[model samples]
Target: MKSGVHRKLLNYFLGEDKTMKKFTLSLAFLLLCLSYLPLWAGDYRAAYEKNDFKTAFALAKPLADKGDPEAQHMLSGLYKVGWGVIKDYQLARKWMTKAASQGHKEAQSSLG
Candidate 1:
């Protein structure tokens, strides 16, 4: 048996466990949280649907800056159509290409 702790933990993500198990659980939770943190905000698309471009922009811009391709795609649309912003094809193209480089599908289609 591997007898060393290849596990880790944090205080905020505590769950039921013994000391070592608690550590491992907390670490796992932390990793999970970190992994999904870039997209943590739900209802972003929902906000867009409600024509709340300001809300959508607010929700998507930071993630877009963080290299989230989907957010980039959304930002491209916001720029293209002037949703909560001034319309600028150049800016739209810029954001679309940024997203396309990150494998965003809609960005590629828009580029076509």
Candidate 2:
């Protein structure tokens, strides 16, 4: 009888531990998906169209850094015109070159 009781208790605890592990894994997966939501949802063009250069810069910078040609072009324009950031022709040229190299037609034309 004592052995049976001990075995039941051990099984209950083991089940609880398994449940906790599943819950922990689910929570981690949720957080991971949420963290990437901004990158997936950022609308830099809408921000720029609204004359919100600061927001546009914030949205575009990460994508530009990740080698997105359109984002690089937008960042280059912002740097060239001193819109959201200080006007830095050097940085503008750097980003424009990156975009042009990626075959961004507007950036290529502007560079030419």
Candidate 3:
């Protein structure tokens, strides 16, 4: 089968030995995820600014679980403030450390 320019471009960029369909799917998924990040963070920020801890927690938890530093920092703050979840210094410290390890400045300051 002839690979299209999209496949060629994906191969060039990714440098991986993936099938055409696999490469296309992976690229699409990556693009979708990247596009959603700003909206997802905006939603989280709106929830946080409104003091809707439950909503903020709901929005941040998945991204945090996925190792997003900002989400981890938000999760840490939520734990620290007993918002949407019980205040747990240990959990806060744990998440803060994770974010700090990812070079999040606020997390670094919090850890310090």
TM of each candidate vs. truth = 0.64, 0.66, 0.67
Clashing pairs in 1: none
RMSD of 1: 6.7
| After superposition, candidate 3 runs with Cα above 4 Å error | 1-37
Model 3: lDDT of residue 4: 82
Determine the C-alpha RMSD for candidate 3 after optimal superposition of all C-alphas: 8.1
lDDT per residue (tens digit) for residues 1-112 in model 2:
9998787668666785566677778999999999998766468988999999999999999999999999999999999999989999999999999999999999999999
Which segments of model 2 are wrong by more than 4 Å?
1-42
Pairs of colliding residues, candidate 2: none
What is the alpha-carbon lDDT of model 3 when measured against the actual structure? 0.88
TM-score computed on alpha carbons, candidate 2: 0.66
Task: Report the lDDT tens digits of candidate 1 across residue range 1-112.
Answer: 2332223233233543367676777999999999996456655677899999999989888888888888889889998889988898898888899999988887898788
Per-residue alpha-carbon lDDT of model 3 for 16-55, expressed as tens digits? 6457667778999999999987886668878999999999
Measured with C-alpha atoms, the lDDT of residue 88 in candidate 1 is 88
- What local lDDT does model 2 show for residue 12? 62
